[model samples]
Target: MNLPNILTLSRIVAIPVIIFLFLTGNPVAQWFAFALYVIAAITDFFDGALARRMNAVSPLGRMLDPIADKLLVGALLIAFAFAGSFTTGLTWAAIAIMMREIAVSGLREHLGSEGVTVHVTAIAKYKTMTQLIALGAMLVVPLVPGLELAAHGLVWLAAVLTVYTGVEYFMKAWPHLSGAKV
Candidate 1:
């Protein structure tokens, strides 16, 4: 119920609007969607900082934050794929990033049952940054020439980092994943 949590919930609430804008098929809508996405991504950073500064962290916020992130990123990637924005290697790269997210989330949930928490790493944070930048570029690609290529490159980079971080998390959690109980 604090500001940070409010911001996090706002990100979740904005998802439907973002989706609507993306589906509108207008250049203006695409710009609006890109702005919304950038705002959401900024909140992802500020919310955590506010939570830490205000000491208002809650289990619900902890749970909701990552889910919101995943939902936003996944929805954008799927939307782009459906819209044919990913005509080249970007589609597979997006798929790879999405798969890593799913795998890591599942692994984290399983590990949580064993009282083991898998903290987000610096590399994971970097991957998220690249993904957001890539997604933002893709959203606005139509408005700018040659930006789509940059977006694709960013996505590919993010995909590689996503896979690397996914492997890192899995390896770190392997012992707990081996039928260990809390």
Candidate 2:
């Protein structure tokens, strides 16, 4: 496999380790998980960029990259939910993000099968970057008490973007979904 593809694979492989470490109830392990997660998130950006830069993009990489992203974000959010990392009011934010991911994925798959491509929008890229940053802040709250409020704010921000992008994607897919000409 090429380096870009390898990087994408590494992110998927890191999912379980990150969740396990974060769930260990130990500060050191949690920090380790956060560090690993940061690395994985960075790779998420670089993998696609490197693939394009090196002309190493492939079908396998294209398929696996988004899957890896969804897994890393969704799995960690669930782990955090189980760990009671989110307050009752904030839990809905996490749920919203996860639900949007699921819905968008299904929409993308359905459209792909119909020979229609839905490109990732710039706002969606910002949404993902905000999500990773928000999660990173949330994960390190135990190590840095000052980050708690900021972390919560970031989560809310990410949720807003999640919903907005979800609606945007749905609107774009609606005409196609209704079997009307694009």
Best by lDDT: 2
Number of backbone-clashing residue pairs for each candidate, in the order shown = 0, 0
Model 1, span 1-182: residue lDDT tens: 89999999999998888878987889898788888989998999999999999999999889989998899899989988888889767888888889999999999898788777899999899988888788888888878898877888888888899899999999888777675553
The TM-scores of all predictions, comma-separated, are 0.94, 0.98
Worst 10 residues of 1 by lDDT: 173-182
Show pairs that collide, candidate 2. none
Q: Which candidate is the best by TM-score?
A: 2
Report residue 102 deviation for candidate 1 (angstroms): 0.9
Cα lDDT tens digits, model 2, 73-169, are 8998898899998998679998999999999999999999999899999999999999999999988987887899999999999999999999999
Name the regions of candidate 2 deviating beyond 4 angstroms.
none
Against the unseen true structure, what C-alpha lDDT does each candidate score? 0.87, 0.93
